[model samples]
Target: MEYITLNNGLKMPIVGTGTNTYGKENNDYNGEVKNEIPELVSALELGYRSIDAAISYRNEELVGRVLAESTVPREELFITTKIPANEEYISSKEATRAAIDNSLKNFRTDYLDLLLIHHPIEDKEQLKNTWEVFEEYYEAGKLKAIGVSNFGKNQLDDLKKFAKVKPAVNQIQINLKEPNKELLAILEEEGITPVAWGPMKTEAHQQEALDEIGKSYKKYGAQVLLKYQIQRGVVVIPKSHNRENQAANIDLFDFELSAEDVEKVENL
Candidate 1:
C-alpha cells in the first residue's frame, strides 16, 4: 500500500477500510452491535492494515477485538477512531479525556494511530476545550495524531486560531458527485492531507467512462476511481462487504493511470 506523510512527519496509508457498518446486525449502520465482524477479519486477511472506525458507529469493542486478535501485530495496524461532537463527549476537558480513555480500552491499544473530532463543535469554548484535550493526549503519547472531519473552510479557520498542532488531515466526502474542488485546493495549500469518505459514489456515465479507461489496464471502474483519488494525493477509505471487492480495493498499486486518462477523469 502507498503512504502519505502528514505534517507531523507521520505516515498514513493511502487506502484504508471504512468500518461504519461493520459488526452490526444485517450490516446496517444503525443495527445492533454483533459479537463478530467477518468482514473486518476478511479485510485484514486481504492485506488491509488500515481500519477507520468511529464512536458513533457503536461497534468499537467488536472492531477492536478483531484487531487485537488478528495475526497482524498491533504495530502494523493503523487504527483510527473519532470522538463525537455531542455534549456528552466534548462538554468538558475531563469528559473528552474519559472518552479517549474509553476508546483506547475498547481498541485494546496503548495508543491510537489517529483520532478525530467527528464534527465541528459550534461553541467556541467547547471547541477549544475539546481540542486542548486532544492536544493533551497527543502530547502524552496516547494519540499519534488528531484531526477533524466534515469541517468546512470557516470551521477550519476557526480551529486555526488557537490550535497548537495543525490538523494532519481533513476527512471529507470527495467523489465525482461531490468533488469539493475548492476545499481540496485549500487543504493542499495548507499542507493538510484530504481523506475521502464515500469515495465510490459516481454517476453511471462517469462509471462508464472509468470502465472504458480501465479496459486497457484490466481494472474495474471502482479501481480506476480510487486510483484517481490516490494518484492526486487524496487518501480513500472505500468499504465493501464482498471479499473479492475488498481484495480489488487494495489491488491498486500495479497500474498507473496515464496523464491523459487522469485528465479525462478530472473532466468527468
Candidate 2:
C-alpha cells in the first residue's frame, strides 16, 4: 500500500479500513457489541494494516483485543482511534488523560500510532484543555500523533491560536457527493493531510463515469474513486465486509490515471 507523510513527518497508509460497525450486532453502527469481528480478521488477512476506530463506536475494547490477538506485530500495524468530544471524555484535562490511558490498555499497546478528537469542541476552554492533554500524551510518547476530525477552518484556526504542534491530519467526508473542495484546498495550503471517510459514496452518474474510466485500466469504479483521492494526495479509508471488495479496496498500486482522465473525474 502507498503512504502519506503527515505534517509531523510520520508515514500513514493512504488506504485503511474503517471499523465503525465491526464487532457490532447485525453490522449496525449502533448495534450492540457481540465480542468478535471476523471482518477485521479478514481485513488483516487481506493486507490492510491501517485500522480506523473511534470511542463513539462503543467497541474499542473488542477491536483492540482483535488487534492484540492478531498475528500482525504492533510495529507493522497502524492503529488509529479517536476520543469522543462528549463530557465523559473531554470534560477535564484529567478526564481526557484517563480516557486515553484506558484506550491504551484496551489496545494492549505501549503507544498508539495516532489519536484524534472525534469532533470539534465548541467550548474554547474544553477545547484547549483537551488539546493540551493530547499534547501531553504526545510528548510522553504514548500518542505518536494527535489530530482532529470533522473540523472546519474556523475550528482549525481556533486550535492554531494556542497550539504548539500543528495537526497532522483532518479526517472528513470527501466522496463525490460531498467533495469539500474549499476545505481540501485549505488543508493543502496548511500542509495537513486529508483523510477521506465515506469515500465510496457517489452518485450513479459519477459511478458510471468512473466505471467507463476504469475499463481502460481494468479496475472497478470504487478503485478508480479511491485512486483519484490518493492521486491528489488525499488518504482514503474505504471499508468493505465482502472479501472480494476488501481486496479491491487496497489493490490500487498497479496503474496510474492519465491527466485527461483525472480532469474528467474532477469535472464529474
Candidate 3:
C-alpha cells in the first residue's frame, strides 16, 4: 500500500506478492502450484498492486494467465521479472533477447514495469556486458526499469561503475532479526531502493514484542514485521496462499510505527 520512487524516477509498491514456491531449494523450479492463481487474484482483490516474479520461479506462464483474466486493468498492476545469470541464457545478445521475449509472451504484457539480473555473474566482464544489454532494453522501452537481485556491495560497485543507467532496485533477503545493516547503509548511500524478499521469516525477530506492537495498531506479528521494513525505507514482497495473510500484507498503510517502537524492533 506504500510506494518508493526508484532511482530511475518510477514508483514501486513498498509491499507486493512474491511468487517463489516451496522446494525452490531442491531445484523444483515452477512446480505448478495451482494455488498461486487464486492467491494472486485474492491479493489483487485485497488491494495488492504489485507482483514480483522471476524466470527461475518457473510459474510465469500460469501467473500470466491469472494476470490476463484478472478484472484489474493491466496498467494498474506493477509487474517485475528477472533474467537468470546462467551461461546458456545470457551467453549472447540473441539468447538474452529470446529470454526477455519469452517473459513478455508468458506474462502476456507488452512491457514489464521492472526487470532484473536475477543473480550476479561470477565473471565480472560478463556481468558488465549483461547489464549493458539490460540498459539497452530500458532505453528501447522493453523494460521500464532494470535492477539486480542478491548482489553484494562489490558487485553493485562494479555494475555502477560501468552502468549507463543506475539500477533502480536491489532485492535481497532481509528481515528484522538480521537486518544486514551494512548493505542497507550502502544501498541508502547509493540511492538504490532495497527490497526485502523474505521479510517475515526472521530468526531474531521478537515475537512477544511484535505481537504487543501489533496490538496498538490492531495488526498481527507478520504485519508488524512488514511495517518495520516499510518504515525503514525498504520494499517488501511477502507471499502467501492464505487470503487472510495476503490481505494483511497490503493492509499496512493505515498507521505509522513510532521511532521508539521501530528502534525497539531493530534492537530485538
Candidate 4:
C-alpha cells in the first residue's frame, strides 16, 4: 500500500476502508446500527491498514472489535475518527477532550492516528478552541495528526490564521463530477493533503459519468474513480461490503493512467 506523509510526519495509507455507512438509505442494513463488524474484520485481513470512522458514524466500537480481533498489530494500522459537529460538543474544551477520550475508548486504542474536525459549522471561536485541545493531545502523543473535513478555502484560512498546528489534511468530497480544483489547490499550497471521501459518487447523478469512465478503463466505475484520485495524489477511502470489490480497490498500483486518459476521464 502507498502512503502519504502528513505535515506532522505521520505516514497514512493512500487507500483506506471508510466506515461511514450510517443511516445510508440504500444499504439494507445500517453499518452503525446493524453492526458491520464482519466486513471490517475482512478489510483488515485483506491488508487494509487504515480505517476511517467518526463519532457521528456510531460504528467506532465495531471497528474497535475488528482491531482487537485482527492479527494486525495496533502500530501497523492507521485509525481516524472525528469529533461530532454538535454546537455543545465544540463549545467546550472539556467536552472536546471527553469526546476524544470516548473515541479512544470506542476504538480500543491508546492513541489515534488522525482526528479531524467533522465539519465547519456554528461557532468559529469554539471550533478554534476545540483545535487547541487537539493540539494539546497531539503534543502529549495521544493524536499522531489532526485535520479538518468539509472545510472550504475560507474556513481553512480562518483556521490557519489562529491555528497553532496547521491542519495535516482536509477530507472532502472529491470525485469525477465534483473535482473541486480550487479547494484542492489551496490545500496543496498549505502542505495539507486532501483526503477524497466519496471518490466513487454512488448517487444516481454521477452513475452515468462513472460508467463511461469505467467502460473506457474496462474496470468497475468505483475503481476508476479511486484510481483517478490516487493519481492526483489525493488519499481515497472507497468503501464496499463485497470482498472482491474491496480487494480489487487496492489493486491499483499495478497500472498507471496516461496523461490523456486522465484528462479525458477527469473532464467528464
Q: Write the per-residue lDDT of candidate 2 for residues 99-160, one digit (tens) a residue.
A: 99999998999999999998999999999999999999999999999999999999999999
Tens-place lDDT digits, model 3, residues 176-243: 65578999999999999999888887553378778888998889978888888898889999988788
**Worst-scoring 10-residue span by lDDT in model 4:** 23-32
Model 1 segments beyond 4 Å from truth? none
Arrange candidates by TM-score, descending.
1, 2, 3, 4
Candidate 2, RMSD to the unseen true structure: 0.7
Backbone-clash count (model 3): 0
- Model 2 compared with the native: what TM-score? 0.99
TM-score, candidate 3, is 0.93
Scored by lDDT, model 2 comes in at 0.93
The regions of model 3 sitting more than 4 angstroms off are 22-36
Candidate 1 on 46-127: residue-level lDDT in tens?
A: 9999899999999999999999998999989999999999999999999999999999999999999999999999999999
Ranking by lDDT: 1, 2, 3, 4
How well does each candidate superpose onto the true structure, as a TM-score?
0.99, 0.99, 0.93, 0.91
The per-prediction CA RMSD against the true structure, in angstroms, equals: 0.6, 0.7, 2.5, 2.6
lDDT of 4 by residue, 167-268 (tens): 999999987668899898888889999999888775675666666767756776667767878888899998887789889888777667778767866667
Clashes of 4: 0
